[model samples]
Target: MPHTYLVFVWHMHQPFYKDLATGEYQLPWTRMHALKDYYGMVEMLEEFPSIRQTFNLVPSMMVQIEEYAKGEALDPFLHRALKPAEELTDSEQEFILKYFFQANPSRMVYRYSRYGELYDAWRAAEGNVERLRRSLGAPGMRDLQVLSQLAWFDEIFQENDPEVRQLNEKGRDFTLEDQALMGRKQLEIIGHVLPAYRRMALKGQVELSVTPYYHPILPLLCDSNIALQSHPGVPLPRRFQYPGDARLQVHKALDYAEEKLGFRPQGMWPSEGSVSDEVLALAYDEGVRWMATDNGVLGATLSSLAGVRETYRPYVWKQDGREMRMIFRDHFLSDLIGFVYSRMDARAAAHHFLDRIRENARVLHNEGRDAMVPVILDGENAWEHFDHNGRPFLKELYRLISEDPGLSAVTVSEALERIPATELPRIHPGSWINANYDIWIGAEEDNQAWEYLLDARQTYDRVVNGPEGAALSEAGKAMALEELLIAEGSDWCWWYGPQHHSENRPEFDKLFRDHLAHVYRALELSPPEHLSRTILRIATPAYQQPPSGLISPRIDGEISSYFEWMGSGIYSPDHRQGAMHGRDNAVREVRYGSDGQKLFLRVDLEQQKPGALAGLEVRVIVKSVRHESELHATLLENGAKGTVVRSTRKRTLGAEVSCAYSQIFEMSVDLLSMGGRSAEMIQLQMSLWRDGLPLEAAPAQGWLELVPSEPSDWE
Candidate 1:
């Protein structure tokens, strides 16, 4: 009677966006996600009493939610959303055009007909304020105001709330009353986020967990050098060792949860599923009975790959008289839900997910042992990409899980009760990414941010020990320390590194520095000059290097040898720009080169799997002075069969291509086919398409250019 226990931990969090000095929230995500995700995620569970899950709520997010619920949050976005359309200044109109349509274009914006119309109008105008201002009158602005807010309302709210439903029916030419009603409804939804979780936890339908206050990486707080353990030779900032701060973050989270939620949380999903031996000790000391991190960490700790059997069980890590149970998230399953399933039909995705779980479970069952599959990921951000905000998918998944006798969806705590723990003698020190701290440390920008934080911490310590600090009020000292803790948050470093990029890069840069500057202001000290400037460098576009020399390699779809393409022109896409949470970039880097007779191109993927590239089409478009031509390649069957490479133009290259799973994808085309003879300059553009959707494009902003080599030089 072996059964599979399914653990779904939805980590809900938003960075602390409030400026303590100004009392104004800098970002509207906390409010936006509150309206769309938090309450509804829990409320939807009521439909299926048999299914149970866990929700990890970060205290900082809850604090902001409370502010919005009480109408104390002075968020500029809210102010703009609530403003009368006719009274909006030109700048305000411009701001609306820039940010109001920030929701998912396909799922959220297009869901509302009027909002889609406004988005199309603004897009058609090429985001020009003057053109949009002339084309879209007050009526357009009013409709945008109502529909922008209305688009974020949870599917449940849209279905149940009369005002929201009426607004949906009205579609366009929304009145001032409609706008005012949307604003009120937003606050009303925000109010439900916390209480709904409390009610769910109380009902035992969901288990509630908490992350560290301000969501700092506890291991790094304990010591920045800990990063070197996972990533040896990584350039680090000045040694930042502050176990006390780490302890405080954990302690505060537990205390806040007990006070706010009317119950003590027994489990902690440390910020970003970041953990170490030291972090475990801290959590265990704080009475955290269980914790979770990605399976990559578990694999690294065991010095072997974590397969299904290794990852599908609970384990105990006991060191130095402190212990806590741990679960490693099924990275593949979780990512499929977060990234892949959004592109799939709801029922099909749900069935595929459940079938995978069942198939995986059947293996363990055959061995006469039960299995535990932990599926954990960010709960809020993925839904925007999903139709109906993923409600249909979740309902289908939950319904399937509830009906299956062999499968049981349980909270982490519930799973622990039924499952026996295996001993993990030691644990790896890393976050969920690659089981390494590279995302938060090692990078030049990440190191610089740590150095800045170290200086601020040193200043605080010196002032507090000196007579000037002793004479300062207790409130001032506390504020200074709070700012230091906020600066310790992992979010600042997430954006600082080269690993990730987003549209709001400058804002994050400013916010991180602002928190550090506030630390000095709280201590009555002048902030450093560096604090006033940005830490972020203007990122170079995707085309980093041009073709250096001729490269003629076998079109075997693999990096056959080190020297095969050494001098190839490389184009690495800057994925940080327009970065969406949980979305994986399929195209890692692209290289192009040419021998006198043929053109060679290669694509490296972030992941190397033939299945991942299956159904994906890659196109290399070349424009020369005289003609334009394209080479199309469709990846299939781990590159074994069904992959076809074709050329569209009068000249054909006899194109050949290959796909190497977990390696490179390469192709070769005849130079004469590309008009290389008549062309003096050649421009290249590479695009990856899946199901007709452009997944990624190289040279994101422009085309890669190469001046054709002189015939004498080619000789």
Candidate 2:
């Protein structure tokens, strides 16, 4: 009988967020995610003992979790959350109002009526601190403090823990004891996360794996110039070559995991799934039996598109008498869970996922070969976007797989044991994105960050290995080395590039440099002046051009002619600064214009028809000086045909708008119905919505201004 082995590896990681010198955490993510994600992820698997999987824990994240579990970690975010409402200073109150409601608006905030009410009030105030202060008294502040923490408690804790359940039931008008109890419950959850993984792994329901000690890109650490292999002619930072540090990172990770979990880990995810011949050799030396990276890398290495048959099996890479077995993740399947599935019904998404897997497996089985499908993605970040932190969907998926006799869920190691492997003479040097390191290198900002890291590394070598380091105490030397390792992490460069963004961009910038500064401080040397300044410089914005002339394009959704929208206003999002990872931006650019009587819009997307936009909705909002109106277009596929159904313009306000889809999305609105006469100018914004959740938006910062032309201007 033929079978499809499903290998699900969940990479659990957070950047090293603690400041060594101050003994304070720069961010609360490590603690917050531990409370919300880590414990539940492993504990839930206990329900389906037959479905086994692997969890990759980075050593940096483990240390932070340990500190948090012991109640030894502190930060401004935690302090503010724990403070009594009456004792909160005005600035602290403002900070709470600004940052406390930073959870998923639909899943987390709305789960609690009080938290949702406070969020609505805050939004209604339009971020006016004075207005918020006047509306929300000490009681409101207390409610926010308790509800903010309560929202992050895992589903298991919410259902089983008495204190957490009591807080959830109370809902509003929380007292000081409630806030204190929430804080204590948070620590209790953090304590459970590591133990839960340990317990599961020992029970053989889970396999524990790990990354480098601080999550550095091992290939880059071994040789920075390796990036040039995939991306020639890319501007690189100063040459940084150190294979010794690469070796040390791997060894340290294995040793730490063994010490903490009571058994040595046999597999490695290699931070960011970054690998090269040199990296494989280093891991091989560290006793790593298996590893994983994106299939895109496998495709580039094979110099062909790696189809299901090519990617659904494990491979062995051998060079210089060293070998390591590897599996390439099914990128599309992994991305669906990470980005798309959250907006779908739980049971439907699970069935769709299993169907895709079975279809792929059927292809291999018909070829008389067994199949192994590897699905890998971040375990923490995706949950917030899901209802009930993704429990229902996971439960459905696991349950279906358990019942299906043809399918079996196994860890990477377990699958590798059952399936024979193909041998590759050489492998490509790349990260997950596009089988290239362009996201972490090449870009000006990325190159600059690398240069800064190089400078810090050189300083550490010169001082610690020289006569000056001899005078330093052993404790100081250890502290300096720890700082250097933390600085080497891939996270700083992740934020430096234009590919992704978060509201805490500046904080990431500061923390990266601060770590380097501590390295110099431990050596008793003056830090470089450049360390005080940020690496980010203002670059060209992504949006380009405003409407210059009239456009009356045909509304068949196709770009009928080159000249139809030649002078239309255009807006493009800077991809480097996008908010999420592993998501495709359906809209490439938005062009809008007016032909005296009607306002015209053409959405140029990277894809058309039943591609990325299928089963999604695009919303167009027009905000005039006095009024706001909107139009909705739902994308659907009927059999083999695709069509976009535009709803009757809700909040029409006498506006006659029509939409069509062909090669592009086109819409036109009657100017008279848009309150063009009532306002001198109007602002327009477009957003991609799924399951009523706004996934991504154009302009990102503010609305695009559209000025109504004077009647005589046409002449």
Candidate 3:
């Protein structure tokens, strides 16, 4: 049959957030996206069963979603948002103000009157939390908290669920009970995320593929030196030659997909469409029959582009008796949806996309050759910027495709089956970005990060290969290797360098260092001092600074001396979008220090309270590769000592600690438990809770790091 075979591989991924040493999830992105994107992306397909597409699910992302779906992940964002507004502390309030409005304002926030009003007030405040807090007040903040979560709920849920629809109707002045219900509803929606995809895959409406475990650049992992072939004279990081690691990742992807999807996926989308000759051979050896990357890689490999004839055909990369089918994505058509279509009317955008696709295939159809147009891009991130999460456009696109006879929306595997494969003699070693590894390796920060990783990998090899490794437990060996693999993922470096920008860059940098440090900590060895510091060679102007020296402060609510915190590291929360992530503020600043024996933390609120502000309380949390502890205290409760709950590598709680609050909030924590090295990265954060709802938090953009004791250090 002469048809334009459209293969859509929607790559869905987010940064790995789980701490290898502790089972805690560091960010709420995976869970948050599940509410808006994951379930609905597949469930929407049932309406147009005639159209089939491929979804490239990263195993790590699926793990987080499954954890969330089972009511297992402890999401701080969800807890704070659902908390009763009256009881929220200054920190919780500030956190809600900053993060809840993270959606595209016009598309998501401004859709509702209350959310729009709050967002406008937030913008007027110019990142001043106190001014914003004063303008919006608690009632306004509460309305925003509810609406933010409600706005992200899928259109299906919005239309079908009575309570959800009722809340949408109410739109303003929501109750405490309503906030709680929304929190519960989020998990309820996330629970359907996996099942929806599974059902659709089970019914053969879609095919599920996977990226390599941890989503590392497979080509770079096989040999970092390959990057030079694609981008000549680029400042190179030390060679990270490990084809075995690349193969293991591919093997794990197949094993995990079979376990989760009931069959080993034949198609693999090398992370970010990254590939090399070595990676291709590794994937094929691991039983991958086909893979898809960007047209750029195909363009670079084939060395010339002779129009749609070169791009719109399936290619067989066969060399040295190893062969695999490959599809080069239609970059122009894919970009129209991912970057351009969001601004246009939904029906218009969908029509324009189809028109371009049909026009592209006309010459092929005239020559009696079926056009294999592979459209590939991110499945999740682009929608939030679009009107109604791009549902109307997708529905319109799906309907038009269902009605069209000359075009057939098919999976990558289906498209390959219908087209004769052209032999691709070779491929350029590069990623989807500019046909090079520049995003992960070129800049000063990226190069420095890669060098650190190489050092960590060398240390792991030395330790595991030495005679001392004889005493290393099997668990310890596995942990060290696992942490190393996670550090090798492409996301950490994505935030590094000059190419991309994220407010969470510091957090990403710290996590990457932490992962490298854990490779040592997992073996009960001391990590190098370099890992204790920031890898961000450059950053925004200062208000936040690392610790200069050590200090010990009293736990009393009142400040006793001016010099008490003089030497401590400080985080004056900057709510400006680029400086830190939060929009509203209740917490003014946080001071971090360690007095050789115990870690010290002091939280300063925007305003001082006399004794008890009705229902205000504070929670101090510390997370490290060794242990995770959370402490709590009621506002100005003179001698009322606070309690602690801890999480360690065993993922169990077995700790009791104390803290005090009155004029100021102060606490001391034993950073490590169970007689282990504490060289891994430490994060400290304080949030205010009032009426059982979190109000504000210090260092709202990300957590403050508590350095391994010596000279005090915190970022």
Q: RMSDs, each prediction?
A: 18.6, 19.3, 9.8
Compare the candidates by TM-score and give the number of the best one. Answer: 3
lDDT of 1 by residue, 334-368 (tens): 99999999999999999999989889878888999
Q: TM-scores for all candidates?
A: 0.76, 0.75, 0.78
What does candidate 2 score on TM?
A: 0.75
Q: How many backbone clashes does candidate 3 have?
A: 21
Question: Candidates 2 and 3: which is better by lDDT?
Answer: 2
Put the candidates in lDDT order, highest first. 1, 2, 3
Judged by lDDT, which candidate is best? 1
Q: After superposition, how far is residue 79 of candidate 3 from its true place, in Å?
A: 1.5
- Segments in model 3 whose C-alpha atoms lie over 4 Å from true places: 540-715
Candidate 1 off by > 4 Å: 539-715
Model 3: worst 10 consecutive residues (lDDT sum): 575-584
User: Which of candidates 1 and 3 reaches a greater TM-score?
Assistant: 3
Stretch of 10 with least lDDT, candidate 2: 638-647
Name the regions of candidate 2 deviating beyond 4 angstroms. Answer: 538-715
